[model samples]
Target: MAIFTIDDVEKTFKSGDVSEKILKGVDLALNEGEITALVGPSGSGKSTILTIAAGLQKATGGQVLFEGKDMTQMSQEEIRKIRSSEFGFVFQSSHLVPFLTVEDQLLLMLDVAETKLNKKQQKQEVSKVLDLVGMSHRKDAYPSSLSGGEKQRVAIARAIIHQPKMLFADEPTASLDSKRSKEVMEIIRNLTKTLKITTLMVTHDEEMLPYADRIVMMKDGLIE
Candidate 1:
């Protein structure tokens, strides 16, 4: 079933009487428990649609429906509430805090999501997520001490620790080498399957397309 739907989405940026249209009537849908890969060259607006669907940005024209509720109609505070509780994100960079331990990172995500877990339960959840990402041994290590793959693992752990219904990944493996990229993609696929999390991923790497259940190609600001 379709869990999220984008209907004729359009985005325009205006500066000094000049307007650029990034998205021109793009439409797509993301199914439940499936990974949808958005692929395109630069300037194709792949990332723009991803961010708009994820509520990180707004569409100038369209209906973004999540679970049948129109996100485009929601206020900033309402959208923020949904983002904190229902959506998880992975970016090109791990974006981990340099000072926080690996376990502490997941714990912080739980807090930000307002998961309502007690202190002890929160710790246990952290341990479980770390194990899932194969970072259990590095739970006490800070980001600076970890390798690139390890940091991305922790970032994935932190993302899913809140049990979000949707995962938005933007060039998640762009910073890693081929081996590490495949490893990270495998982890993301496995976790998304096991947890039944619907994922919308934007990636330019052709090598990673096989990992996604569906591939959407974009060109000239439209699905092609």
Candidate 2:
């Protein structure tokens, strides 16, 4: 079965009497262990698709299936459980806790979201992920002390710490310089391959297309 399947999904926002249709009859799928890039111009419904798939928002009409289980009908609590245990997210900003150390940020995620790893196992698991993202040495440092690239690396480490089956990244490199952006992309691609993590990233950078196994383009409310 596919890791994720979106079948004829639609989303519309109601503003008083008129409704704005954002996504119109969309269908998409993701296989295990592959990196897919969702590319598009602004207002192309890229983030909307990701948010719906992540269960952050309900589709107006249609189904979202993960491992063949429909999330559309699941309770909010159930969907939150699924998101915490099975998926990870990275955004344009690192979004690390200002007061927590890098290690603490990662450990907190495993504590609240994942159940498969115990305290000892969690530490070991997080260690390996930090190393994979080349943030091992800075694990003890606080977010305020790290550079932009370092903070991003730590964010990536935290996202994968629990070993989520799927990852969603939206404009992950939007805040980095050209050189730093390239480095971050390389690390993401390598780590995704090593862990066999299925990833869908929405990005505007055409230079990073070669790293993705497949590029899916969206325009307005449809995939083009």
Candidate 3:
């Protein structure tokens, strides 16, 4: 089955007596282990689509199915559980905790409820993911000490650390130089492939399209 299916989804908002339609019956799917890029100009609702898929926002109409279950029907607590166990996220900003080391940032994503790992095993898992993102050398470093590229890598590591089935990334390369952006994209693509994690990224940079297996173009909230 497809990892995600957004079937005729729509979102609307109100602005003090003014009603605005953002996403207008958009349909899309994310398959396992592939990189899908959502590209568009400003105000096309690309971020809105990501937010809805991530369950951060509810669609006004239609269904969002993750792993064949309807997202619209789940309770708030159930949704939170699904978000924690079934999905991961990476944003343009690293959004790392100011007080946590890079390693701790990743550990925070692991399965804490059913975890059988001791401190040593947990450290090993952290080491494995840090190595995957090529951030092992800086595992002990705080977010303030890392470069933009390194910080993004750590964010990616944290997202995938728990082996979530899907990942949503919004403008992940927005802050980096061209070279660093390409490197970060390559790392994301490679790791997604290796882990068989379905990844959807929102971006406006045409240079990064080549890294995506599929590109979904949005215009005025409709997929073009």
Candidate 4:
């Protein structure tokens, strides 16, 4: 079943008297436990659509549905709550805390999401996710000491630590080398399958297409 859907979504930006339309009537549906990749050249609105569906930005027109509820209609507080709990994000950079240990990053996410797990349970959950991302050995290491791939692995661990129902990855592999990129994608794909988390990702790397279960091509603010 589709856990998330974006219907006829449109986004327009205005500065002074100038206006630009980033997304124009785009539609998409992401099924449970599947990875949907949005691919296109720069300025194609791929990232805009991802951000809109993730509730990070407002859509000028149309609906963004999460489990049949229209996200566009939700209040800012409601959206923030959902963004903190049900959804997870991985950006182009690992975006980890340079001073925080790997384990602390996941701990912070659990705290932010207000997960039901107690301190001990939260630590255990962190361990499990770290193992999944192959970063268990580096749990106590700070981000600054880790390699790029290790940092990304910890970032993935942090993203999934809350066991969110959906994950949004924006150019997740953009900062990695080819080998590291493939490895990172493997972890993401395996986690989505094993945890049944629906994922929508924006990636410019054509080589990464194989990791996605569905591919949506966009151009000039519309799906093509």
Query: Which lDDT tens digits does candidate 4 get at residues 1-224?
Result: 99998999999999999999999899898999999999999999999999998899999999999999999999999999999999999999999988899999999999999999999999999988998998889889998899999988888888888989999999999999999999999999999899999999999999999999999999999999
Give per-candidate clash totals. Answer: 0, 0, 0, 0
Most accurate candidate by lDDT: 1
| For model 3, the run of ten residues with the poorest summed lDDT | 109-118
lDDT of 1 by residue, 69-170 (tens): 999999999999999889999999999988999988899999989998999999999998888999999999999999999999988998899999999999
lDDT, each prediction:
0.95, 0.89, 0.91, 0.94
Task: Please give the lDDT score for candidate 2.
Answer: 0.89
Off by over 4 Å in 2: none
lDDT of 2 by residue, 88-150 (tens): 888999999999988899999998785777789878877888888888898889999999999
Model 1 scores a TM of: 0.98
RMSD, every candidate, angstroms: 0.7, 1.2, 1.3, 0.7
Off by over 4 Å in 3: 111-116
RMSD (Cα, Å) of candidate 4?
0.7
Point out the higher-scoring one by lDDT: 2 or 3. 3
Model 1's C-alpha root-mean-square deviation from the true structure amounts to 0.7
What TM-score would candidate 4 get against the native?
A: 0.98
- lDDT sort, best first: 1, 4, 3, 2
- Select the stronger candidate by TM-score from 1 and 3: 1
